[model samples]
Target: MVIDLPFIWAALIAIAVLAYVLLDGFDLGVGILFLGYESGHQRDIAMNSVAPVWDGNETWLILGGGGLFAVFPLAYAVVMPALYAPIIAMLLALVFRGVAFEYRWRTERGRFLWDWSFALGSTVAAFAQGVALGALVQGIPVENRAYAGGWWDWLTPFSVLTGVALVVGYSLLGATWLVLKTEGKIQQQARDYAVRAGVAMLVLIGVVSLATPYLNPVYLERWFAWPTAIFSIIVPALVLGCAYLLFSGLNRGYDLQPFLASLGIFLLCYIGIGISFYPYMVPPSLTIWQAAAPDDSLAFLLVGALILLPLIIAYTGYAYWVFRGKVRPGEGYH
Candidate 1:
């Protein structure tokens, strides 16, 4: 059987990106939450909760980017130019945050500086990602397989709104993660943050959902069409259900359920996005098949991906399992 190599690669990249968002997202959320706490010990506990697995979680992002470059070079070419500024900013923020993770422990006098760097880095990175998503969803100007828009084309009110929304979303994820990973005062603080962030997230989701159709008509048509419309209801239904679970779980002092429920909300949001733009990779302009590289190149890449992807997943799972436990005071990356 002649396999559809392009489709397979597309699916693989999608999954990789989803994994990156969910895994790295919570850590980023934790970083954002650092700004809220005054206690150094409480912050230490939060840092330790994510310290072991955070770097490993970022590997999925690398996989997603590499897969895109290899399998859909055309899309990469167009997208990179369109989002050059935000992408560069995101990378720099990630570098700062990574360095903060190590340096915060080394210098007692500079710890405050490093802590701010970590929190600000995480916020900037998350916002840049959201801006990129907003720009893509609103449709970049593409002509002759190239970006036709100016550098500032990505700066818009909708993009800004999405950026703030993502900050709230990631903060929620981080708060839930703390709920699962820490105990005592830090855990209670995280539970409080989770409820606040979760409510803000729901409001942003509604705003984005309402604004999406107005920003682009295609999303409206795809979402409300007859047979598909009925299916689409499942997305919102699951979101509401998960939101309820998150709140109830936190209120009931269930450590793991809130985190799991927050993840469900993230997954449902991703699925809704996929449903809105299934065949299109560039939104209203480029189809997946149109952006795909040559079949022979994809076939070559697929062989390497098949060998490497499973191993990466196994290692990631193992790391999480090894680090499974509650973080306490005076315990961290030292």
Candidate 2:
């Protein structure tokens, strides 16, 4: 009996990527929402809300990227050249955001510099991520087992739309997260932002969903064909259900439900993407097996991953549990 090492590694990498998106996503959202706060103190509260777990949340990103490079080098090679611009922008933005996260707290005189840095960095990182995603979804041209596309291949109208969509989506996540983690005027402001962002998110999601199927015949069949078409109905229905929860939670002033529902919407969208890209690590050209490393390497990596993944999860969970509470003015984990 042969173990499907490639499939296992793919699943692990997928899980890591999803964890990064769901966890780091909100902090990025919070940073993106920074400038919207009317007062500097409100910004402080927002930053404090995420300071405890933000750095930790980025661990999954490292794991995901490392797994891709080590376990699926071919996919990494193909994807990197296709997405160099956005990927580089994302990394630089994240670095700026991190530097701002620390430096903003140190000096009162030049703090505004860091404040704008944080906001712009987070926004750019989120946008770059979305553009990279859009570029990937639109498909990279491959020839002779190499990237055959131009340097500007990633920049397109559809990719720009996705970039905008992600910025709005991340803002919604930040707003709802603030609703869950802060109180007083900040919470109220966040609730308002959540409503506006939520509506925009839904509309953008609909537009993206509609446009995505037309990008590839495979996507059209994966989404709209009989048998699999059940997902077409089911995913949207679930999204509607989540939307109801989100709006109702806001209307009723419930704390956690709206945030959870927002997360649900993201999860459903990720699942939808997965359904469309199953069996393929890089769409239009490569399958998981073809992109994967040798079985010996995969097996060795799996042993270490099995040991490390649980530890990371446990640490992340413990941090959140320890820090669970409302972030008031002038109080923070840092």
Candidate 3:
């Protein structure tokens, strides 16, 4: 059988990106919520909650980015130049955040600086990611197989809204994470934050959803067309169901359920995006096969990815297992 290498690579890359968003996302969320915690001890506990696995969570990001460069060179060429600013900002923010993780522990006098560094870095990175997503979804102009838009074409109102929406969404994830990982006053505060962020996230989801179909006629047809229009009903229904579980879990003081439900909502949103961009790698311009590298390279990489991906999963799972349980005052992973 002839292997559909491009499709397989696309799926792998997509999974890798999702794993990065869900994994690194919460830690970044924790960082986003860092400033709101007035008590230094509470902040310490929050940082401890993620420190053991936070850095490791970025492996999937590396895999996703490298896979894109290798497997879809054409898409990469067009996308990178178009999104150079936001992508550069995201990378710099991530670097600054990583430095703060280590340096904050080393100096008492300078800790405040590091704390702000962490929070700002997380916020900027999340915002930039959302902006890039918005820009992509709205469509990148391509002419003669190259980016045709001006340098600042990415900075639209819709992209800014998406950026703000991501900040709110990540804050929700961070708050729910604290609910899962801490106890006592911190948990209570996290619950409060989660409630506010959750409501905001749902509203933004609705706003973005309403606005998305209007961005491209294809999206309009994919989402609101007769046969596929059932998704418009079904996806919202699923989101509402997940929102119910999230709020109910918080109300009932259940730890894990709220976090899981939050993840479910994100997963469903991701699926919605995939539905909109099924055949396109660079939407409205390039399809997966058209943008892919030679088949032989993809097949070779597939062998390596199949082996590497499982090991990464196993390692991540084991780390979480070993570190399972609540983070307490005066104790930490970092």
Candidate 4:
């Protein structure tokens, strides 16, 4: 029996990407919510809720990217070129947002500018990520391990809608995080935002669900095909269940349930996408086996990945544990 090393690497990289999205995603969401908070104090409290762990949360992104480059160099080569614009934009936005995180408290004179920078940076980064996802799902032009698409191929209406959807989705996650991590009127305000954002997120999910099949017939086939289809429905059903639980928990004034539920929704959505594009890493183009690096190289990478992944997980868990509790105004990573 042959062990599929490439498949294992693919799954590992997928896990890393999902971890980044679910973890850093909320912090980014928190950054976006900074725009909604009019008071500097409110923003400060919100920022502090995530500040201790935001940088660590981003490590998964680096892991995911690095793993992809190492394990599936061909996919990296094709995808990087296809998504050059949005990827660069997202990187720049993240850089500015990280800068804002440090500088916002350094000088009163430029604080306002820094605050706007954080909010704009978060918004653009999230939108760019969604656009990139949309472009991938809608299909990138790849031929002979290269991107054959025009520069503007990624800028379509569906991709734009996905971008807006991600903004609202991230904001919802941010609001729930605030609800879980803060107290006082800010908590109440976050709850209100969560409810509204939840509604918007649901609508976007419906639109995306409908549009996905129209944009890609392969999705339609996978979604409605036999036993696989029956299993596939479970993902969306779980998402809806999470949404229901989130709303119920919010109404009951439960602090952590709503955030957990929001995370569950994101997890389910990620799984659904994975189901839609299981074999294909470059979406309708390159399959994992086709694009994977040599098995010998994968084996070498796997040994190092095994050693580092656990340490990263341990550190991340410890950081969250150390900072666990409701955040109060003026008590944070400043």
Candidates' C-alpha lDDT = 0.92, 0.94, 0.93, 0.91
> Each model's RMSD to truth, in Å?
0.9, 0.9, 0.8, 1.0
Candidate 1, residues 88-122, lDDT tens digits: the string is: 99999999999999999899988999999999999
Candidate 4 structure, TM-score to reference? 0.98
- In the range 201-239, model 3's lDDT, one tens digit per residue, is 999999999999999999999998999899999999999
Query: What's each prediction's TM-score?
Result: 0.98, 0.99, 0.99, 0.98
Misplaced by over 4 Å in model 2 are none
Candidate 4's displacement at residue 334, Å, is 2.3
Backbone clash count, each prediction separately: 0, 0, 0, 0
lDDT of 2 by residue, 1-334 (tens): 9889999999999999999998988999999999989647889999999999999999999999999999999999999999999999999999999999899989889999999999999999999999999999999888888999999999999999999999999998999999999999999999999999999999999999999999999999999999999999999999999999999999999999999999999999999989999988999789999999999999999999999999999999999999998988768844
Superposition-based RMSD of candidate 1 using all C-alpha atoms, in angstroms? 0.9
Off by over 4 Å in 1: none
